[model samples]
Target: MLKKLYLLPLCLIFFVPLIVCEKILILPDHLKNFWIAGVNFDYFSYYKSKVLLILVLFSLISLLYRLRKDEISIKSSKLYIPLFVYLFFIIMSTIFSKYKDISLWGFPDRYEGAMVLFSYIIIFFVFALVPKIKDTQIILNSFLISSFLIGVISMLQFFNLDFIKSYIVGKLHIFQLQYLGKVYIKFNPGPRYVYATLYNSNYVGSFMAISFIVTFILYVLNNEKKRIIYGILSVIMFFSLIACHSRAGILGVMVAVIFFAVYKYKEILKNFKFVAPILIIYLLVYVFINTLSSSYIGNKIESLFVDINKTITNSTNNNLRDVKIYNNAVCLNFDKATLNFVFDNEKIFATDENNKRVSFKFDSNKNEFLFENPTYSQLKYFINNYNNMPVLILNNGYDNLNLIKTKEGFKILSFSGKINNINPVDKIDVKGKEKLGSGRVYIWSRSIPLIKNTLFLGYGPDTYALYFPQYDYIGKFLFLGTPSILVDKPHNMYLQNAINIGVIGTLAFLIFILCYLIFSFKAINTLKDSSLSTISISIFFALIAYLVAGVFNDSVVYVAPLFWALGGLNFKILNN
Candidate 1:
């Protein structure tokens, strides 16, 4: 019974990705409002947490039972110190948080608060304590199988397997066809990007990126026939990764490959004949996929270069010209300079050198500005004070603007407008033409300042959204079309941690990760068992890829557990 109980957690681990892939299996309106830990009691996250909690409890019970019989011995490692310290800080941060509920349970939108953190810690300890080679194999096999299923489904989606897509969508009613919106551009619309079972294509890419490395490592360790099979799986996952069209994912895989090569230079040289065939196969598959979808893939790659070049040469000149204001039955043309204050069709106010308020009435018939006390100086002041309004002064064009007063300063609220040909600026709506890092540069620039104020203790876990608004000036200008868009977390995971849990917490977390990596790599270097060493190195490479991708993306519910679980399994293998 105790042995069987251990299998339950492993089953739950595999079950997670399957349900998450099917879009969280959200409940209906009446049932959706049911809350747990302050988050909506959905099937995916809620059930997964419950299962993990049960697993933790069962593992504890089993441990106690074994302890009484003297069947097991407690083993300690260097990792426990930093891990416990990090958990301590997590508790302290949550307790002292201004929003304790949110800190403890996470925000309703993304439940990754103290509770989830606790669950992750529980999972880590469970694996670390088990210290069984067979258990480690079970976890790795489960991961690979789940990942393979995801890869196959994503490939089918990419090929427009409508029956499969329809079946999955029908089963998971939460899956929306138009979820991509502005993120992905569909030129022909068979399926521009494949999200597979993940929330977004980038997420699918992140998953596939890790899977690719794992599958390749399995191929490397397997015998002749098994190597051939694993090699095919690796190729399939690589293609699926490309289908996701995630530049960050591709970049991460490249980085991992470089790292692996540098680390295993001797092994590569010794096994050149084995590696060369896999490389050739990879190249052929790449060419075939690229050729099959030349317009989509080729254009995407080409646009990347164009966007990079544009960012380098793009000037920040004022391109807000031919500004048109419409009120009642009147339309008036104003130069980029001649817009002092625009308050969303409610009012227009401008001030002169004498601190005199100038008011303008729109003439319906004339379609021009009618000043109460018209003068050249007043007109000049109106133009000169254009900067005073909360309008976005893009180098490309002007957008309909609204002003809102905040504690910091005047913030812009923009409405969608078309860019004129005379002075067109690159708007954010032109999908695939975004600046490098997908506007992360601007987001990070605004977000970095908040860390100084909350250096010791942060706002709270999963409370980055609370502080995001104050630093969202660039977001407003960039996403003029989507005014309601809110960036809760900085794209970078490290930055998100720093903002949410403070510098000390972030440092502790980093220490834990570094220690895990150090220990795992050391084990891999010294292990005599080829299969064990290969698996260890594989997990390390996958983690490296994930971390590399994380530099451009924050941790999500779908991926974070997988990372932590795999890390824990590494610890288990090391101990064994």
Candidate 2:
């Protein structure tokens, strides 16, 4: 039974969700600022890597044994050529990487090293090459079953009854960590970011998207007793997707559904009745959730077009009133008048709303301008995140004033807008739009430049953090709201590949994936009403959905294994 079910162990990947781990960097004197203390937890990547490594080894041996007995060779698959090219580049990158040890095994927190990359590739080759149609069918069923449980847990988390969290599940939960020789556990504080087993809410969004696509495809294909089961699963996964509030996942859903419609147009048209009710239910649920959550769905969509610089500028506009920036100065417009305050060349020049320059006494001892205009005395100000975010507080001094001056500098904290005096070219850059897509733009901008180094080969797999300008303090503080925050992943899969394995390798990876997609696409017409065809089409779109979501999400241990496994299945089906 174990021999027949040799592939069943691959399904264990569904149980391993990803969490950001911190590791104490044992570095040289220069790289001391890398981290204060690392986030190493035994629950995630360490265990995940171990499991994947075992799977890789087992799969490799099994494939080789099968090859010895059959005409099948790994080289026979068209995928091998491109994948080999990608692997070659990754090897070169690993060898040439400054942090060779890290390149081989991955960074301390992230375990997506060269070895792990091979694990992913082997997992792909195993399912794609080794699985028979009958065996693949069982694996697909396992996926749906696992997804049902993931949906249930996510639903529980959404409703604030997360029983699987560390506090309740002991050490089995993903958030358990050991830092500084002490157990540092991440507990759900309350009904906030309901990540479920995926650890990050964004990952949950991406996971649900794949699940939803598969469930939808499977449900649509079945005109039998199992149809209702898959329909319910679709709804569950859809709800989970929306609950996670990941806009990228939503984008993926849109792209996949469009392609799904194109592929299954005839089936959808014939079974319009079956599809209608489910879609309506989805619409109703989406509407209800959005209504309850202050129309965040609408806001999130609308924010994509809105200028982030203006948003930041307007954050404290109520406090500062209408501000018009002049040359090293700003004109504050009010209901009755305006105050023109100039700070050019470290000198204070104040003009009242009456269009007359107010004679302000400079108290050099106290570092404050004393304006004598019968309306105010001393111009005192500071900065804080009062109710909003990084906002400047300026007024008369006192608790009643709210602008009481402390020893702290009147720091801007970090201003993302134009201190550049609004030139014609409009060079606001990514920092100005850091809040866009929840800072995806900032991450992308930073990651794009490193693509140059990867024109031939990358820095190395999972060495993104080591190369990223974590010391861009102003950018970090302004965009990420903290200078000390760690950027572990590029939050984009393609960018991740380009940075880790190099652009040439990324192209190879693209070719490998695109070959599968194109093959599946072309094979759809040849497919009849058989269960194998149904499973094939379903897994095909699931892969599409997962890749689409990868635009705004990096590949993580939680989701990548299942993707690779299923993607391999598609490769097997489409090629055969």
Candidate 3:
């Protein structure tokens, strides 16, 4: 029973990824900038945290008893020094954080706070320090089984066969909470376009980026009968990943395949029989993608081979050339009205649907638009002449438009006559980008300026959202189609750590990961045992795939724990 402690982390990798539910949350006031007051539907992180805490509690008690009895020994101590340094910075950052409550437990939606970070450490250590576990195969199999199921469900969802979206699922999935005034939220399986358990299609893509290659490599490494099963699962995972229509995920898969090929070129040359069948299956999938009954998966796959820009446009829709927002203004050129905006010398010129020209007066002192002799019944309006994106259209009765251009951007007063944070569509200087990753360009440009202030100690764990320029209403409106969405995550994992844990802590984490990668390569090259070599190399390539995906996706709770679990397994294989 005592030796069965390893099963705890297995549960995290298996059950946690499969779980999704709508749970209620009471959000703090400061978070009201985006999160609704005392209401949320946490489909990803809530249950994962519950499982994590339970595992951590049990794992800690067992670890303490073993340490007292001198039953375990951690090898390669120098590799872990940076990990401890990182842990120190995490604690310090949390201690000095302004939003300590949020720093400790994390936000309701993400749940990636100091506590979760601490749990990750314990999870990593459980696999790293545990002596000579015989059931490591079970760990990989558990993840394989879990990912296969996710692939099946995602495939079903892409074809609109998801039972989770049915009425029966809603009636069956209700729970009673105390003091929440009968809080009930519907189970949203995200978009119908192949979003599985993860909340967003982008996150689903990231999750598959990690799992797909691991499953594929397992196919390459296993025996004949087992390899066939893994090969089929690998094909399913690849199809589901394509169904997600996430460009970042596809890029990560490409990187992972390139790295794995180079890493094991010699072995591939030695074992052509083992590698040929999977390659054939892969070619078949690539050729017949259109036959798959799904949403835009066929188009996305074809775009990769044909027109890349179309895929980029479909993926994010924030095409720089065709974007709805531009420098200090929203662009109305792409709208159905086909109206154009020209701001000249503080004068507003609007061409109506009937092509009638109307002029509006701008009062600098009062910060209001004054329309004179309006010939058109409907006219588009911007916050100011300098930045013109059509957010509001005034009726023929003239204008009550209170528009002001602030140093940051533009602000418009609410209809209630009270000053609100209602900023219109505005963007900084992003010129001629004109494609899908342009949205990344918008956020990255804004997020980089904020890093200068957080070089020493960051805002705190999971605190990236608080400092981000959520009032960049124009950027949000153009890229995301709504200013109400919070810029809670920095998408890039490196930027997230730099903002949340400071650049120093990020450097420490980098050092730790670098050391692990170096060690993994050394182990694989020098590994004498056939089975051990496969395990180490598979884990290495999988981690590489995930880190590549992290360039575009944030380390969200739904997918990141599995990466950490695989990290632990690498240590186990190397040290043992």
Q: Say which candidate scores most in TM-score.
A: 3
Considering TM-score, which of the candidate structures 1 and 2 is the better prediction for this target?
2
Instruction: Provide TM-scores for the models.
Output: 0.73, 0.76, 0.79
Q: Let me know the TM-score candidate 2 reaches against the reference structure.
A: 0.76
| Candidate 3 residue lDDT tens string, 385-489 | 323422332222333333344454435543333344553433345443322363676687678878888898888999888888876644554455444467788
Which residue pairs clash in candidate 1? 21-197, 337-383, 338-383, 396-424, 396-425
Question: What does candidate 2's lDDT look like per residue over 1-576, in tens digits?
Answer: 666655655655455553233323355443344533333433346656666777678777777877898836554767578989988988999999988877887765457789988788888878877766567767777788788888888877767777656444455243344333454444443563457766678888788878999899888878778999999999999988887788777778888999889978999999899999999999997887678667876676556446444545533221222335444455655434567766544345678777688786766564455666644432353333433323333442322122111133122232222111121211135423455677777777677877777899899888899888765543443355554467879899999999989999999999988887786788866866477788888888888888989988998777888888888877777666
Candidate structures ordered by TM-score, highest first:
3, 2, 1
> Compared to the true structure, candidate 3 yields what TM-score?
0.79
**What are the Cα lDDT values of the candidates?**
0.63, 0.69, 0.69
Give candidates' CA RMSD values in order: 9.3, 7.8, 7.3
> How many collisions per candidate?
5, 7, 6
